[model samples]
Target: MIEQPRHIKSIPAYKPGKSSVDGWDGPVHKLSSNENPYSPLPSVIEAMSHAVATMHRYPNMAAPELTSLLAQRYAVDEHEIAFGGGSVEVAAQLIRAFAGAGDEVMYAWRSFEAYPILVRGAGAEPVQVPLTPKLRHDLPAMLAAITPRTRVIFICTPNNPTGPAVGHDELRDFLTNVPERILVVIDEAYGHFQTDPSAARGIDLFREFVNVAVLHTFSKAYGLAGLRLGYAIAREHIQEGLRKVAMPFAVTDIAQAAGVASLAAEDELMERINVLVAERSRVEIDLAIQGWNVTPSQANFTWLELGDATDAVSAHLNSRGIIARPFSGEGIRVTIGDAAANDAVIAALADAPRPSA
Candidate 1:
């Protein structure tokens, strides 16, 4: 029998939401994975269709066109951009390239669920700092956790599962204190949905800080989740190292074409984001009225702090043909979908019996 490494044995795999299940009859409204409910921009559809005729040809390994467009849009050099299958892939590459055995990677607990997984996969020790009571990343705690062995730090702004983001001043101060040798990653997967002006912009930080890398995805606000296109912005040297480790032709021709088109349709997509933001605010207010503790989210979802009722609420919602992501005993994460889907989730909760006073 082949003996696997000890690290592989202890590593816990990431569990994404189930897309479909056998024996399920009713329509399932998946508010589990935070994907854009809005339809893909028409320009993307057109570009995808155009690319279909050239599937026989190999995709451009350099992703030159998309990288150029992204660099221009972000006002960074093209050498600073690196493409991956998704932002998740970029995270893994960052960890693998900079961190290794005996190295420490620091991040907030329950921030991006994938942080520890990626760190462990790279054979590095994970230093998980607990989130503050307000569900925001405890930057000070995370900074304190950093040691000389620390190689990479992940900051998930408008963090996954929890929803609250680190503010600009807080991030600036944290970056100032952290040593330049430690690579800092700002995972901005849901950045476009942020309505708060005070929230930290990853790309802007990337420009000012040589050690920081910012990741963005076409999956959320751009409505191209299925295409699996994401990119990272960092210093030229960091980008060079990440690109060396990245899989060749990682971003498909169709995905690249679609991403380029989506960039052009940013204005229209922002309008859709505005609508979802409004809906998210309404949902938060309504849930509060129903006596449920909800985190104020700038992302495309809200974290419902149901306490012990987490399981009951999740089961009840699932029974009603709705699916939400339950983080074991912590709470439930409900993604913001279209008008009807959002209404259905709220209605499901309203229909469930409230606890005894």
Candidate 2:
């Protein structure tokens, strides 16, 4: 028998949102994963289709064209960027690069589910700070949690599972007090869908703070989840660190081509995003009118802190052919789907039993 390290064996597997419902032969709307309801833009499709001819060869590990385009778009130096399989993978690389045995990585709990998994995989201690009752990151609390062993801190804006973004001024103040040696990662996977004017733009903060790194993925607004492409922007040294730890040829040619095409078609893609934002607003308003206290979301999903009633509501949603993401005892996160799907969620929740006071 072989023995594994305690940390590796203790790490819980990441559970993704469910894709199907049992005993439901009817039409299903998968709101479990916060995915774009639309398919890739035609221009992006064409680009990927053309790239298929080059599948016989290995992809350019440097991804030159995509790098140049991203650099120009974000006004960052070309050397300050690195690609990953997804923002999650980019996060894993950061952990592996900056942390090791006995090091501590800090992040808000009930945020991105992958944080602890990545930190533990790197053989680092995970220090999870609890969110405020309103489901927002407590920056001061996080700052207080830091110690000599703290190596990395992740701030997920428009935070997953529950949607609320950290405002710019508050984050600026938080960064002012954090030690420069600790790397702070701002995960902006859902940043594109954010509608709040006061939310901190990770790119903007990345410019102001040397220790800051920003992560963005094409999965959300760009509708490239299946292609698995994400990038990180940081100072040249931090970028180098990430690249040093990155998997060789981690990003494929098809994804690179699709990224270029997506940028070219930004206007058309943003139009679709506007539609989803409007739908999100509608759902929030409707839920409020029905007496449900929903966290005001700037992202594409809304969160209901149903507490002990979570499982019951989730079961009801399953029966209605709507597969929403539920966190057992905590709450339910419903992605804003197309009109019909969103309507189904509203209808189902309206019929769901209210939790006792």
Candidate 3:
């Protein structure tokens, strides 16, 4: 038998959401993935249509135009921006560039499910610090867990699954105590959804700290998940390191055109964000009134602490044609979709009997 690497053997395959099932004729609302329910901005769609005619030629390997637009919008120099397939790919590149077999990569447990997996895949050891009682990253504990082997630390503000974010002051304090050599990755994929004034905006921190790299994605609020566009903003040196590991022409021409156009439609996109934020507040209030333990979410999704009942609740929702992400022993995460989809989820929960008190 051909020998497979031990590391590859131990890694579990990523579980993507199921799209369809036999005999399921009911209307399916997929809230499993935190995707934008609104339509892609008209400007983006028009740009994509125009780019389709030029698909014969290879895309720009450097993504100069897109990077230039991003630099202008984010107020960073063009040399400080690097584009990738998505924020996930950028995460992988960061690991490959800075971390190695003996190096340790630290992040909060249950923040982004892919963090540990990506870290391990890059031949690095993953050190996951447990979240605090309030379901936020225990920065102090994570800082204490760091060793000389530590190379990179991922901080997912407005964190995944459990939806609270670390405050700005807390982040500044944490960075102050962290060693200068360690690279800090602020993965703010959901940053656009955050409405709180105190939430840590990765770009703001990236401007202040030379060691920090901030990753953002068009996959969430921009409603371009299918286009697979994301970018990282960092100091020039860090950006160059990321570029070294990036796959050539990884972002397609259509995606680049779409991204440039979408940036131009920021005002229209913000209107859609306002809608999601309003709906999220409504969902949170309704869930709380119904006696479910809904975490105070600052992102585009809400997490319910269903405990062992997680699987059962998830199955019930699926049966009703509503898909949610069940985090096994952790809990269930439901994305805040359009009003109708949100209503369907709440209605299903209201219909199901509460687990014994």
TM-score per candidate, chains pooled: 0.96, 0.99, 0.97
Give candidate 2's TM-score. Answer: 0.99
Residue pairs of candidate 2 with colliding backbone atoms: none
Residue 343 in candidate 2, Cα distance off native in Å? 0.5
User: Best candidate, lDDT-wise?
Assistant: 2
**Global Cα RMSD, each model:** 1.6, 0.8, 1.2
Candidate scoring better on lDDT of 1 and 3: 3
Q: Which stretches of candidate 1 lie over 4 Å from their true place?
A: 20-25, 353-357
Give the candidate order by descending TM-score.
2, 3, 1
Q: Compose the digit string of candidate 3's lDDT tens values, residues 1-357.
A: 998687767666787766554556988888988999987877899999999999899998777788888888889898988889988998999999999889999999878988878987888998999999889999999999999999999999899989998899899889888898999999899999998899997888887788999989999999999889988888988877888888988999999998989888989999999999999999999988888889999899999987778888888888888888988766889999999999998888886545545
- List ranges where model 3 is wrong by over 4 Å: 353-357
Q: Please give the lDDT score for candidate 2.
A: 0.93
Q: Residue 152 error for model 2, in Å?
A: 0.3
Give a tens-digit lDDT track for model 1, residues 187-271: 9999988989999988778877899999999999898888889888999889878977898878889999998888888888889
lDDT (10s digit) by residue, model 2, range 102-175:
99999998998989899999999999999999999999999999999999999999899799999989999999
lDDT for every model?
Answer: 0.88, 0.93, 0.88
Q: Superposing every Cα of model 1 onto the true structure, what RMSD results?
A: 1.6
